[model samples]
Target: MSGRQGAAISRDGTFDAFDLCARRATLEGIVDATTLPRMADGVADEGGLARVAWRIEGTSDALGRPALEIGLDGIVPLECQRCLAPFEGPVAQRTLLLLARDERELARLDGEAEHEVVLASVPLDALELVEDELLLTLPFAPRCERPECVGAATAAGAAEERTSAFGALAGLKPAPKNE
Candidate 1:
């Protein structure tokens, strides 16, 4: 699905406290080209849509700006790296966000390279963050348990060709030998 959108930020500059109780969040109107976080091992691929939910908690900083913590639980459909089959699984992660009131603070926090820093002048979309984190959590290389996972055997049934990309050139004729 394409054109999906994340949960909307509220006008109050804070997520509705009641939303945390709903137990579900629907992200809609997002575009297909959007990318998610991926596992460093190169096993996980976030090439498609994701559905998510989160439990949120928050408090105020010294200036009364909202600071939020989110615990995510969700599911995503992905293709197996080995079998090339599609499957669905759970995605879980934790994120903390800081809401900034002034443009200067937002710019300052956004410029920081620290991993934990997330700056927003208004209420941030927790669902988007959760989706992205799930992408990051994916395995670098997902594989199927079956011996046929790589399609080593029964090569004909495999979805992909077994030969190397250069195989075609190998068959080309060499110059003729002396008569």
Candidate 2:
């Protein structure tokens, strides 16, 4: 949880809904994904901030017949697949996340399935969701900016070895014929 930080959710599970009701919302808190419900290192040199945003349509769940939507945007450092260098990039996505309280309510949410949104029994840890998405977005191999990278060095070495092998074969030729 090094350099970990994020907003606090009240015990009653309420935050200012209005604050995040704009076309875009900027949350200032380091949501230490290490502190999320379930998390692990899928690859090496993985870590950083996972900022989130909520684009509410109607209102918070506390409001009767309330309907809301959320969107997430942030960046995390990921190791490059090609060169194994670290790079910071965006992790942005928009989806429907339900805040319903029971399975019955969750099923009802499915009625709005065309929305492709999420239905949850509890208040979602917004930061955690963003963190997980960002982690999953990481590339399989990390590459560096330098054209002549560590991988290139290895390639050069392999080419030299092949050339030496060919030189040995050239020496085993038949003798020249005379008139």
Candidate 3:
């Protein structure tokens, strides 16, 4: 059966942390980027479909905390930062979020220089989880990957037209030496 054959799960229909971990639950779904309110703005107004896969399995991370691994595969249309033209970019994101039950543990993990952990309540919204991962996968300043792009207007010409703020300020005079 298709992973999404069942009725759509609501934000209130909760998943049991214990059952998920015990059964190693796996779920899949499709998200039309154009319809997701929180994420619609980030993608182009054109075609955008996301295939999502997620899993929650038993792990020693802790109890009362949901450790979810999310995988995202899709293509998002983005405007090139250099050329200001639109292009399709491939996205494949896989991440592990270590959730902490209390502030103490959250703080401890935050203080660590290596990994990140979130403080989330159990029975969290499943669709929200998928949306969060998708949002995180977008590029901050998307640029086309075409090799021809290197010396094209998107790259060289644009760089030549825009100067750093500091560079622009460097031309200032010293007020006639304050004489």
Name the best candidate (by lDDT).
3
**Tens digit per residue, CA lDDT, model 3, 1-179:** 32442333344745544444444565566666556678766776654454344433333344434465667777777777776667887778876666666788789867863444656545656667767777788888888776676568556656755665456777674556655
Tell me the whole-model lDDT of each prediction, alpha carbons only.
Answer: 0.50, 0.49, 0.61
Per-candidate total of colliding backbone pairs? 15, 14, 0
* Model 2 bad stretches (over 4 Å): 1-8, 11-28, 32-65, 111-113, 116-123, 132-179
What is model 1's C-alpha RMSD?
A: 10.5
- Candidate 3: segments with Cα more than 4 A from true spot: 1-14, 48-66, 153-179
What does the lDDT read for residue 111 in candidate 1? 74
Q: Model 1 off-target regions past 4 Å? A: 1-51, 59-66, 135-179
Model 1 C-alpha lDDT versus the unseen true structure:
0.50
lDDT of 2 at 168: 88
Tens-digit lDDT track for model 1 on 29-62?
A: 2322124333322323554555556555554434
Highest TM-score among the candidates is held by which one?
3
How many pairs in model 2 have backbone atoms within 3 A of each other, for residues 3 or more apart or on separate chains, i.e. clashes?
A: 14
